[model samples]
Target: MSTTWITRAETAADIPTVHTINAAAFETGAEADLVDALRTDPSWIPGLSIVATDRHDRPIGHALLTRCHIGTVPALCLAPVAVLPEYQKTGAGSAAIHTALRSAADLGEHFVVVLGHPAYYPRFGFTRASTHGIGLTIEVPDEALMALTLDPEHPLPAGIVHYAAPFGI
Candidate 1:
């Protein structure tokens, strides 16, 4: 595992390598396929797909934030975060996630939704979404679906989350 903190956007050359990393990091191919499809979808938000690299700038992890909706309100979705098996727990995934969120904040994005492990995301300031009146169109465990108010001034949006075409949501 590498201790490097560098994170950057995925280039054309990195896409296939990223797909392999995602497929290997997870038990299923869904996430790997999502990454590939999102690249061509109209919903693909440039600069929002990120990869964490080692000292040589070789990608070792990925974290993607794409356009999604909470009711009629625009929001970012964090999904398909994957780290190479060899780099798991090395902070590479976390670094990529943190960087993507921070860049979103700087771009003036206010809200983000995530369907992820209940234990992992809260460390990044995510909270139970229902407390903010946020609900999903699909049935999901209350804790597994979370919302984060990236900008304290803008409260969390309330309603269903509709992901992009690539997500099959």
Candidate 2:
């Protein structure tokens, strides 16, 4: 297991590998199918989908950020982050997520929301979404729903999250 991995925005050529990573990481194909649906959805943001690769340049982890809203304000949603079974706990997923968030910030994206592990997400500066007045239309564990302000100047907006249509929320 190499400690160092390369991260980059996903390309068309990487799609199949990315899908494989997601499908392998989760118990079901739902996450993988969601990725496919999001690609054609209006919420898709081109550069926000990112992957982490091993030395041989095979994608071993994937992360995605797509358009969602907190109330009427624009925001990004982070979902279905996946690392290949062999790559779990190797920091490949973290590298992919960090790279994707940085790319989102670079693109002038302000806030991001993720429904994920409370313990894991906070290391990336994520806090309880409810603390910042952010909620979801769909019920989820309060601690699991995290929010981050990519830019310090822009605070996390307060409201219910409106996820993309394919999310079925």
Candidate 3:
């Protein structure tokens, strides 16, 4: 397998493949279902859903960023990042996430929050959200909830994360 991955904004035709990737990556279909629900939700931001493809341009990993809020301030939520089980640990998911975050920055988005593995997300600049006074409505491990600022000029806002309805947070 090539170490390099091609990352790009997900197209309509890539949706089913993305779903399959998510379903296969996780323990259940909930993550895939959440991605499907978020697709039609108002929070869905075009071009923020990204995919990593193999040499033949077949999508093997996916990442999605959706509209959310920190208190009343607008932000983005990174969720359900998935890679094919066979592709796990091959940098496919990381490539898709990096691309999605870059796309968000290019679109002038500032803050992003993710509830994920503390060790995995920090490489993407995510830090313990509670350190910045960021939290969630529901209880989660302080380390599991992380936040990042795409632009250092605009520091991460401190508030409770209000995820999109589909997240059911």
Candidate 4:
């Protein structure tokens, strides 16, 4: 198990490996299929889809950031983060997420929303979205939906999140 995972923006060649990671990480193919659908969705932000690779440069984790809206304000959605089952607790997923968020920040994106584990996401500076008056139209566990402000100057906006079509939200 390599502790040092290399994170980078997804390249054309990494697509298959990414798909496999999603498939292998989740019990169903829904997440992997969503990745495929998101690829062609208008919300797709090319460089925001990131992967974490092993020492041999084989992708073992994936993270995607796509266009979404918080009220009328532009924001990003972090979804379907996956790490190979064998690498579940090895920080591969974390590296991919940190890298994707950093890329989003560098690209001038301000707010990000993620429907994920409350305990896990907080390490990345996420807080319950309700704290910022954010919510989803669809029902989700309150604590599972979290938000982060990439830029402190621009606080998270208040509104229902509009996820991409593929998300069916």
Candidate 5:
């Protein structure tokens, strides 16, 4: 780990650049737009949205964990994870993801789901959510829906995921 690359809880000051990073990293504006909507809702869990900052403290990467549900059980949803185009493959995104997951675990969040690259997410301890009988209401690639039990004492819940209101899922 590079000491120069700092991972910190996002402050209001970092929101704009973090959004910019997301917009630049993705082909479409959906992720950046989703982050904007999340900030306005009751579901925004402070400290769950974290940033990886450069030495000068400018955000170059971001990872957000927001409230969701597996049946009636509360869980977290990881989405729109992004790093600046130049920072991809350099571990900036990984650092932000790790920091966010650690914070979620510390907050006693029991489970988290992500629809992402199958290979990449497993490196973070995510497994096939279907094996646990968890799925989404919307259609998606089977291998892309993954989950992680942040608190091993509480096994992942099983049911169709209902994302926060702001997510429109």
Candidate 6:
């Protein structure tokens, strides 16, 4: 029961464990299936998928970033963050997300968008996407759609987010 989590880029061996974590964290397996689909999609960015491991070095949480666009400008889409049911509220999910975002930044990715819980994403520097003229094709709560700029020099672009094909958005 340690609070510390080891985060890293997901490896091929971790796929099954990541899928299991996603399936168990959500009420349905759609998120898990989406992850699998994204893996083979052209939008897949290597080293953007992250995992948080327990003391035993077993992956208990996951986060993924994939290529997307803001209008025609390249960006990233963060979705399907998942943690094991027993590990929820223990910061595993947060750790995985932070690592994923950091990894993206290290790879020179500048902008990221996430459609998720307002409260949760804001902690990671995500602000209302609408404020920047960012939106989705489909309707969603204003607060749920947020964006972040990894580099202050490059402001978040304003436009409709074009997510990967797996997202079906």
Alpha carbon RMSD to native, model 5: 1.5
Q: 1-169, model 5: which lDDT tens digit per residue?
A: 2444689998988888988998999999888999999998877899999999888888898999999889888999998799889888888888899999999999988899999999899999999999999999899999999999987789988999989887888
Pairs clashing in candidate 2? none
Give the C-alpha miss distance for residue 62 in model 6, angstroms.
0.3
For candidate 4, the per-residue lDDT at 35 reads: 95
Provide TM-scores for the models.
0.96, 0.98, 0.99, 0.98, 0.96, 0.99
Residue-wise C-alpha lDDT for candidate 3, range 1-169, written one tens digit per residue:
9789999999999999999999999999999999999999999999999999999999999999999999999999999899998889999999999999999999999999999999899999999999999999898898999999999999988899999999998
Write model 6 residue lDDT over 48-125, tens digit each, in one string.
999999988899999999999999999999988999999998999999999999999999999999999998899999
Candidate 5's C-alpha runs over 4 A off are: 1-4
Off by over 4 Å in 6: none
Ten residues in sequence with the least summed lDDT for candidate 3? 133-142
Clashes of 4: 0
Better of 3 and 4 by lDDT: 3
- CA lDDT, candidate 1, residue 95: 97
Weakest 10 consecutive residues of candidate 4 by summed lDDT:
51-60
Q: Which ten residues in a row have the lowest lDDT in candidate 5?
A: 1-10
Once fitted onto the true fold, the runs of candidate 2 whose alpha carbons sit more than 4 angstroms away are none
The lowest-lDDT stretch of 10 consecutive residues in candidate 6 is: 1-10
Local accuracy by lDDT, each model: 0.90, 0.94, 0.95, 0.95, 0.90, 0.95
Residue lDDT tens for model 4, 1-169: 8888999999999999889999999999999999999999999998999999998889999999999999889999999899999999999999999999999999999999999988899999999999999999988999999999999999889999999999999
Per-structure clash totals for the candidates: 0, 0, 0, 0, 0, 0
